[model samples]
Target: MRVVFLGLAVPNMNEYHNMFTELVVEFRNNGHDIMVVAPTYDEKVFGMQVEDGIPTLRVPTLELFGVGKIQKGLATLLLPYQYKRALKKSKIDLNFDLVMMPTPPITLVNVASWLKRKYGSKMYLILRDIFPQNALDLGMMNPKGLAYTYFRKKEKEMYFASDYIGCMSPGNIDYVIRHNPEQNANKLHLLPNWAWLQPNLGQQEIIKIKDQYGLLDKFIVVFGGNIGKPQKMENIVALAKSCTTNKDIFFLIIGGGNEKEYLDRMILREDLSNVRVKDFLSREEFFKVLQIADVGLISLSENFTIPNIPSKSLVYFNARVPILASVDLNTDFGTHLEAIGAGLWAEAGKTKKLKEKLMYLYNNPEKRKKMGENGYQYFKNNLLASMAYENIISRVTNT
Candidate 1:
């Protein structure tokens, strides 16, 4: 099948391991032609190139991220127009069987609709980030305001344009259905976040990473990825603060975002000796460090009405690391983890409960190892790239 994948992220397979690259590679291996129509802000003109044997069309637009909120909003609002104009100028082949896109801006309905019209393609929506509502839940946007109304309309348009909507979790599917009663109920399906599993690190390499980071004898609890508002970093701060009494337990935070400075200040002001903060690591180094991690961490704000299953969890699962999740009650993330026997969880604001869970892990290595193995097996059976590819292809092709 000829497919066009659309999103804000442009995956360079050599630089990092991402789900999109895994899906693209698998599709190509199965004899499918794929074109990645991704946004690029570095160039002023639309350009085309072949990367890793797949055609990538880079469309120039007001850059997303690394900008203020207002500018970011403007860029997101203009993405569809920029992408459409760029694609038209390319004069490339438009015969596509399926067109897949993810939600962030929720402003790509125009481009996806155009592709569907032009090629009679089946448009698939990977509902990774539900918009306007997420903003509303975070109090980032007023639901009754004009901006929210406008984006809500666009969100509906995207939903209507999609033939199939693959939600990140069952909770996500429920949220969409409850809020958007007009949407086709049959279209939504549970599609968990996935990662391409890499080979396990050697014991020597793992030891080297542990030693280099001075974590050789510490029980490492890692919080890795974007330190943004939705993460409700206060919970992480509280967790870190509570662990100060236990010198054997360490909080290793690796990631940068709007909230990094806040975390930095807190760590410094409190003289957090048990915690360490570092900028984002290279993909190779990040994976190596994952080997020494005793537990992987995921955080979500209590304010979020939407159940967000962070894609970061998939990385931990790929590395066979058990999760320590602090998410809202509405989210099924904790429930899923418990069901899989892969991890423990506590509510976002329940620092006491989190401390108890942490102590449990500290007191029990057998439990930790068993949970990590269960997580790895669960990842292989449920969240593998092959599973996602087959599910998507089967649905779209009725195969």
Candidate 2:
């Protein structure tokens, strides 16, 4: 099979590990020809390159990440045009068996539609982020405004263009069905986030990480990933404030985003010494910290109407660390955790309830250990990268 993946970023496969790269690697390993088309901020870096045996075409685009919302919006709106022009200039083959993309910039619908028309390709959408609605939910956009109306149309178009829509959770599937009644239910399938599993870090390596970070004999509760608006990081700050009296319980936040300054301000204002914040770490570094963590924290804004299953949880599950989530009521994340006997959760913005759950994990060592074991078992049984590869391959081939 020849597959072309369109995504926001394609890292150097040898130096980075992410869900997309891992999945593409699986495809490459299984004897599929894969081409990744992604954006690069540096013009000099824009071109085709084979990284770790996968051919990737880096298209030049405006700065997207860590920029103002207006700039980010413009860049997203230009993605389809940029990608199309780049593909033409490169003179690469357009005959793809599968055209795959994960949502963020739903504007890619145009590119996908063009490819499908040109080559009769099957479009697969890895529905990670639901747009426009998520914007409205976060109060980032007015539903009555032009931007919302435009993106809402694009969202539908993207869905229409897709031959199959792979939802992250049952709640996501339900949301899509209820919202887009025109979409065929048969085309929607559950394709959870997946990762290339890594072996657990040894106790000596864990101790070295703990010592290097000045974290010794403390129950580390970690939140690692993008510390942005969707995260509702204030909730994590509130939790940290609540736990300040307990010296043994420490909050370690590792990530960078627009909200990091806000989080830092809150921590300083509250005079909370138990909480520490670190900037984003490499994939290898993150798992080392995760391995030493007692609980992996997940936070979502209470405002979100969409059911977002954070990809961050997969890292926690893979690390054999139990999750303690404060998420919106709409998501099935908490329910999923409970079903797997992997963690506990509370409704977002409920500091008291979140604290109680955290305390429960802190007080019960045996339960925590069991939950960690269960999470690892669940990861092996359900969330392997090979499972996702087979799921998509079987559907695309049979159809």
Candidate 3:
């Protein structure tokens, strides 16, 4: 089958690794013809290339970084039109069997509708990030405002146009249905965020990695991902502040985003010797860090009602690192971690509880190793790329 996968996330082959990449690779391996339509702000004209044996079309869209809220919103609002123009200009055969897309700029209903109409393609919505409502929950946008109304309409249309809606979790599914009661019940499916890390580090290699990262003798608590507003990263700073007296415990915070500078400022201002910040590493380097670390951290803003299962935690799971999740009470993310004995959880922004959990894990070496093993085992059994690929195939074929 020919599959067209669309997303804003254009993966760098040498550096980037995510669930999307994993699924596409598996699709290619399974003998499906894959076409990736990803966004690029660097190109004025649409660029076409073959990446890692898969044909890719880079659609030109407005740059989203270092911009104010209004500018960012305008750019996102224009993406669908830009994407449509690119696809039409490419003049590729309109014969895709399945067209899968994830949400962020949730204005893809127009493109998806066009694809379905032109090619009789089955549209699959990988509902990773729910919009409008998420913005409303965070007070970023007013529900009664025109912008919210506009996005909400697009969100509903995207759902209505979708042949299948793959939700991140049970909570996500419930939220969608509850909010949009008009949506078809049969169209929804639980498509978990997958983890496909294959680590083969020996004891010596692990020690070498720790030494390389300056975590040789410290109890490394690693937070490896986007340090964006949604992360509620101030709580992480609070955690570091609370643990300042514990010389053995170290915070290795990696990744960059809008809120990253705030963390840097806080670390500097407070003279928090226990905390360290670094830019994003290549996937391989990140795995090495994860493998060497004693604990992994996952966080979400308390403002979010959307059940975002941060896919980053799955990377930690694959590395056999015990998790320390600070997420909203509404989300199932922290709960899932605790249930599987993969990690401990605290409410989002609750520094006191986060400190307590961290101290417990730090003091208990046996528990740390045991929880890490449990997470790894659970990941192997239930959350792999192959499993996700199979689920996608089943949905596409059996529908």
Candidate 4:
């Protein structure tokens, strides 16, 4: 099978740790020819490159990350055209059996439709982010405005264009079906986020990394990945403020995003000495930190009406760390955690309940150990790249 993957951003083939990259590697390992088509704002990095035995076409695109909503919206609106133009100019063959893409820039619908028409390709949507609705959830977009209407239309087009829609969870499948009655129910299927599982870091290496970061002798509650609007970072700040008197409990925030300044300001304004914020770390560095950390923290905004199963949870699962989540009511992530005995969760704005769950994990070392072990076992059994690969291949081939 020859597959072409289109995404907003894709790392070089050498960096194959993320969900999409891992999935791509699985296809290649199974003797399928795969190519990546992604956008790059850096002119120096634009054009095609064969990285570590994979052909990747980096089409020049406007800056999308770390920009204001207006600018970001414009960039997203232009992405499909940019992709189409680049693919037309490139010498790489467009005759692919499958065309795969992840949502975010839903405008990619046009390009996917074009490819399907031109080459008779099967279009598969890896639904990671549900846009327009998510923006409305965060109060970032006016529901009645033109921008919302435009993206909502694009979202529908993307869904209708897809041959199969892979949702992150059961709640997502339900939401999509209930809201978008035009979509075929049989087309929606579960495709949870996955990672390439790696072995845990040795104790000495973990200790060295902890000491280097001045995180030694602390009950570290680490929140990694994007610190964006959907994260509801204030809840984490409130928790840190409440735990200020407890010298043993420390908060470590890793990753950068639009709301990073807000988090920094709140920490300083509240005189929080127990919290530390660090920029994004490499995969290797983050894994070491996860290994040494006592708990993994997940925070989602209370305003969300759509269920979001954060991909970061896979990192915690792979690292064998217990999770303490404060998420929106719509998300079934909390239920999944409790079912597997891998973590605890409370509604996003319920500070008291969140504190209780956090403290329960903090006070019970044996329980934490058991939960971490359970999570790692579950990841091995259900959430590996190979499992996701088989799921996708079997569906595509059978169809």
Using Cα atoms with residue i matched to residue i, what is each candidate's TM-score against the true structure?
0.97, 0.98, 0.96, 0.98
C-alpha RMSD of candidate 3:
1.6
How well is each residue in 250-319 modelled by candidate 4, as lDDT tens digits?
9999999999999999999999999999999998788878888899999999999999999899889989
| Stretches of candidate 3 exceeding 4 Å from the true structure | 14-16
Candidate 2 lDDT by residue in tens digits, 45-84: 7789888888898888999989998999999999999999
- Per-residue lDDT of 103 in model 2: 88
**How does model 3 score by TM-score?**
0.96
The digit string of per-residue lDDT tens for model 1 on 95-133 reads: 888888887768888889998998898999989888987
Q: What TM-score does candidate 2 get on C-alpha atoms?
A: 0.98
Better structure of 2 and 4 per lDDT: 2
lDDT of 1: 0.86
Q: Provide C-alpha RMSD values for all models, in order.
A: 1.5, 1.0, 1.6, 1.1
What are the clashing pairs of model 3?
Answer: none
A best-first ranking of the candidates according to their lDDT comes to 2, 4, 3, 1
Please estimate how well model 3 matches the true structure, expressed as its whole-model Cα lDDT. 0.86
